[model samples]
Target chain A: MHNPSQSGASLEISDLSKAYGSFKALDAVSLTARQGEFLSLLGPSGSGKTTTLNMIAGFTSPTSGEIRVDGREISTLPPYRRDIGIVFQHYALFPHLTAAQNIAFPLQRRGMPRRDVAVRVAEALEMVKLDGYGDRYPRQLSGGQQQRVAFARAVVFKPKLLLMDEPLGALDKKLREDLQGEIRRIHRSLGITFVFVTHDQEEALALSDRIAVFNHGRIEQIGTSRELYETPATEFVARFIGEANIFSGTLVRGDAGLALDTPVGLLPVETRLPAGRQASLVVRPERLEIGKAPHAGSDPHVPATVRDVVYLGSNRRIEIVFDDGRTGIIRGSGRGTDVGAGERIDIRWSIADGYVVPFSSSQTGDGHGS
Target chain B: MLNDTRLRWLILFVPVAVLGVFFWYGVADSLWKSFASPEIGLQNYAAFLQSPAEMAVLRRTFLVSIGVTAVCLAFGYPYAYLMTVTTARLRTLLMVVVLIPFWTSMMVRTYAWVALLQNNGPLDRVFKSLGIGGLALIGTPGAIMIGITQILMPFMIMSLYANMVRIDRRLLDAADSLGASPAVAFVKVFVPMTVPGVVAGCTLVFVLSLGFYLAPVLLGSPQHAMLSQLIVQQVSQLLDFGRAGAMAGVLLALALSVVALGAVLARPAIERGYGENT
Candidate 1:
């Protein structure tokens, strides 16, 4: 009978930093999650996303800055006093406890009456569609069921903020997709603010209302999934979030507001940066049109050889190697003019589709330059 | 030849025959001699059971075993927990410390205890300096308990540590995040998970203590003799093989019962602890 929306708390973390000797795991990271918002901290391994979540959960303390929950500072508090619920990647269900007992643990810790604890445990089990599985131990359950029990145990306490650290990372692809839907449904019904940490970009985009992309102990960008995918703020975000063909070059001011003067040609970009500054123009695979000859349009086109052509049911993914030996991908309709490998083709995209972002050292290493 | 079934059985036979001759045959002989020695009857068991002196020895043996198990558990749990929590280098150092006792001769260690507990020895002198004078400890149950506990402590820590290291420490963090205090989580979650180790360690120490001959005899007196001491007395002094066999049979039965009880109590916990963690 607990009202989750009423109990939801706004979590604001500002200038949080954790230093282990000389290495800073979290360096001045700041973000906020409004009440009932589903925010995801998305990053690769060692990107400080999990560190931020641990700081919020009070498992890891910050060396400096504040963590405020509903306007109350809780940075110095122990994890038990924080009243926060966390679901670890390993599911962390008490192997000794049954599913019901695992859900009842938090309530029992709070000294809830036995009758109330049992009822709440039953409700939590039912919430996760595991009502009849209450008596089974974690080992007796499947991985997906165990994760469901973990989710139930985390939220059964009606904690204002719930943090999940790669909770679905262990499950198979099919189970992960199924649980993603279930998680969305649960988040909607419960209305508790959730901060999920994951390295899977598609999982972040499909599940989060907003995502904070992290890299090298810092947040590269934070925005809606559409905004992050369409207008990524930095070269790293563009490469990390999704497939992008980046044209690295110096920016030049032409008849178009700003364009990237690359090795291939001058690619028109619909983004603003200081003229003559080095930058990269990011273009999505789906936005690019590929054909044997240049289609009549004002969009800038690049000549390339089709290296590989993958046929999906509804779309064809063509891997093209540019004249400069850089590879790019273009997703077009499955039906085409029979584009084959080793065939010459022209790939073009409109200026509005090309996003310009400032270049960084990380972009030059491996993924972005490709 | 190695893959042949008969050859595999042949390879397995040598050790089995050695154990049968050297170990099981002696055990069976003692068991039969308990009843058949000095004519086949129940007189040895009855006489030993009816004698208040013998009964006192039996009761004291059990009490000492239980005391040793309790003392080992009390100290070893924290030590084992510390071993699990410390850094790998420190844990290795602690492991070496525990294993150092195992490397030395038990007799040597018990003799060392005798020197320490003797009148005006290092321990006695320390006690006297601390104002606890006239503390004659060498021939007391306290001295024996200390000796046996030191010898048996390595078993307890090793068992507890082996079980504790496999425990996913994140479960404690999960408990803390669920609003359980550190102490509550340790008692309810951590301690319960370590029950298998507790059972294994306690059962081993108790069973070993029941048949202990060296520490009790060296550190204790005839007045406070344990069951093993009385059995040795019947054999060496009285030359009463019947009484000695009866006492040995009783000790073996008690040890077996303790082992069976430990297995029964610990099976469910061990199974639950080692469930299929995908």
Candidate 2:
């Protein structure tokens, strides 16, 4: 019988904040996720992603704020009463119990019939593709096997929300990728709300429906992977998410709308910012095009000399020094041109290809804001 | 490789020589004294084993040791668990309480139990005030159990605490997050992980209790005489070296057998218990 309450509860976290004396681990953070959506909290260490997950799992109390599941507030409830499942970084499986017994724990605790518990445990083992590993203790199993057991144990009780905190951190690169696929498959089949936390950008980009980028105890931006990559809200998000070359200059009104006046000459921008204020040009490396002569169009063409070329498998990163003595990098397929060091080149990028971030020029003479 | 082997053998040779001199050498001399003196050929061994009176005392010794073990486990397990869960200051306080008993002399501890359990003593006075003096427990089997448990309780708690500290607390957290209430998680996850400690503590207390002399003398009457009392009497008052040597040999064999049997039973648990095992 399907539970009337099993409606795939949507999660709403509001104004969640945590402080350890003077150091604020988490600021007023709020987010919402539709039921059955896989959302990832992506950030560097000490950026409060784990703290937010901890608060949602009821492991730690928020200094102030509330968490709601389908309009039900569960801020003060104990962990066991909150009906949440959590997978830790270390597997944390019961060392004395076999894989089957470990999965059977929560079901048995809920007073489910003994026969039903056994049936569900076997079902869960099958779900993780560990059907025959029921009798091995944690020490006897491989790291990947233990990881699957931990995942199986968390979901066997049919929790409507699963929070995983860097669950693949301890495994090698190959196994991490392997278990990530398993986790994505399980999330699809379970149809429950999934909130994952990780610092790896590629993992977050590959697995999340929407990624909330965290920085200094705040969520800087939350959106689809392409949105965050193409147009980040701040310089911090641009630098943290992936490789980028940022150019700072004064914003000026131009025929193309707002253009940034830097040492390398005028460059077009797509965003609105106060004229004459110090702003930044956030350009993804792949957006820049290099050739012997710049392509003629509405794009901004600048002159540069190739200083070094690094050969990455599918692409080559052409490190260049502009004529203005400022450095810039252009990533492109190495097949395009046989450009070598000391070659004069021209780089072209359309105004819409990059973003502009304006900061308070009052904060610093150099225009870097806190 | 040859030099390494020679150095390793030299390192092992010291303890082997020490055991040979004090343990095997003493055992061979005692065996000779017991069997050869007062006419050889198993005469004294046969005499001691055939006496029903001495057999009864041996039987009682085992019963008392078992009783003491049970009592220690009942109190020691909770005390050790408390040490694991408490705050730092409270843990220090509990540790002091456990180690204070160990610091006291065994004779003094036995005498303390006697002082409290005797007629119209502090404990009996409380019972008398409650009009239950008819249940006077002094100079009985219960007194010996109480006295021995107090003396041996420290060893049990320390051994248990050592193992409990190594248990990954995150396992309990994982259980709680999986929808187990705190009480259920503790019973199902935490307690099973501490089996090695329980087995080790119980064996230590039981084997050590069999050789107790002071507590049984002070707290128990002659009607409840144990094997240790018989061995002590044979040597101290009767001056029967041959009889005492024979009885000492028997006690040594019993203790060794208990340890050997325990090792055989506990091997699997030691190899595959709570933490990483290879």
Candidate 3:
């Protein structure tokens, strides 16, 4: 049973920034997590997700920021006084300590009675499904088992907020998937707020109630997994969260409300960006309909040559090269006539299906569409 | 592959041949002389066991070696820990500082200590300036310990540093996140993990201290002669090879037993602490 006082704590981090000389690792980043919220900070490597996690755990002091837990400022506190639990990428389990002893370390430090410590350690072992592994040393365990011990050790104290920095990054895929489900179950049962940092978008999408996408030391966007996938705010979020076919052009008013004029043709666009401004139209592969010729409907269509087709069990991934020499993918259903390489085809999507992002100067020449 | 194996054996045979001729042969010759020289009997051993003065020299040698080992560990543990935690540039500087004594000969360092520890030397003048004059440290066991600890510290540091470099420092951070304060984390987590290093350093310093000769002969008084001094006096002054051989045999046995005991004490800690899989 969880203690009533240890249910969860709301975390509010404001204007957190860390600068080493002129290079800012985290720049004026701000975010919050309500009690019992499962929030994930997702980004590529060196994107400040880990820096934000370390600052919350008090392992690193920010250049300027305030970290508050349940309205109490803990920015100036030492890590031991912060009472936050952190799980590292490599499980930092004490090799000399047995599973039970490692789990009991925090409780003993808190001056719990010895009898109570034993009871709590036993409960923790069972909680991590390591009931009989209390006597074994860390080396005697497999990677998955050692990580389970690390997770048990972190949560055995029942800290209000838990911060994990790529906790599953060291495990194999099957083990990682299993642990992800275990982590979600534990989060729900403990009802504690969790701030997890990871680079894997699928892991973030599978785990978090709200995902914060980080890039270049700033929060690109923060929203639920579905919201991030369906309606990304920027080109970076659109490309980073999932696959997107991007077409860069100037926005122009067409028969449709707004269209992007590109080398191939005018593509339908949907965004708040005014006309005559540069923008990029993002279309998900599944939204684009591929055919030998233009469909009977009024959907905007563009001619493209098929470059390759990879058949999945349920669907096929068809890679197509546009007339402008840019590449795009289409998730063709299993029923389409076998489109081979070098075959010309027409691809179209409805106006509402295209999402437009303001074009910036940074998106050129990276060869991102492949 | 057969030629490679033959070449490996030839390379190994070189050291074994040299040791067999120069080292083990010498040991066997001395053991034989301890029993056979001047007459066939245990006369040299009985003569050694009979003399209270000689027995006192044996006891004092062991005591001084233990004291030197203890002092070396007290100073070297923190210094080696500092080497592991400091930046790479600072660590290289610290390493060079520790090795400066090693660059010079041991005799020269011992003579330097004689100057510092001798009566009214630089150390004495400093004490006098501080108004704590009349402290006679030069001829005492304290002076001998100081000389030997400084000379043998590099051995202790090297042994400790070799083992300490492999320690994963993030365990301390883990301890901190688990609610242990810095001091508690050091004692409960960090210190225990470094047990192998501690054992290695102590064993090296203790064994080296047992065979120490020049430092004690130069810095220590004749009235407080160590076992080496007694063996040398027996051979060079008393002209008794049998008695000297017996004393050398005793020293070798003492060093071997200490090393074997250290291995016994350290095996479990080394196995448990360095599993490293986690």
Best by DockQ: 1
Q: Give each model a TM-score.
A: 0.95, 0.88, 0.94
- How do the residues B17-58 of candidate 1 rate in per-residue lDDT, one tens digit apiece? 999999999889887888988989988899999999899989
Error of 3 at A255 (Å): 2.9
Error of 3 at A264 (Å): 2.2
Worst 10 residues of 1 chain A by lDDT: A361-370
lDDT of 1 by residue, A80-172 (tens): 999888999999999889999999999999999999999999999999999899999998899999999999999998888999999999999
In order, what fnat does every candidate score? 0.85, 0.73, 0.76
Q: TM-score of chain B, candidate 2?
A: 0.87
> In candidate 3, what are the lDDT values of residues A1-370, reduced to their tens digit?
7653469999998999999899999999999999999999998887899999989988889999888999999988999998888888898999888989988899999999999999989988898899999999887899999899899889888899999989999889999999999999999999999999988999999999999998878998999998888888888888887778888899999764788899888777777889999988888998888788766676778899999999896888989999999999898675563789999998888888888888866532322322
Which portions of model 2 show Cα errors greater than 4 Å?
Answer: A1-7, A254-256, A261-266, A291-298, A301-308, A318-329, A335-347, A358-370, B31-46, B104-140, B218-223, B237-242, B273-278
Residue A37 lDDT in model 2? 86
For each candidate, the DockQ is 0.78, 0.60, 0.73
Clashes of each: 0, 0, 0
Q: What tier of docking accuracy does candidate 3 attain?
A: medium
Tens digits of per-residue lDDT for model 3, B20-104: 9999999998888999898888998999879999999999889999999998888888899899989999999999999988898
Candidate 1's TM-score: 0.95
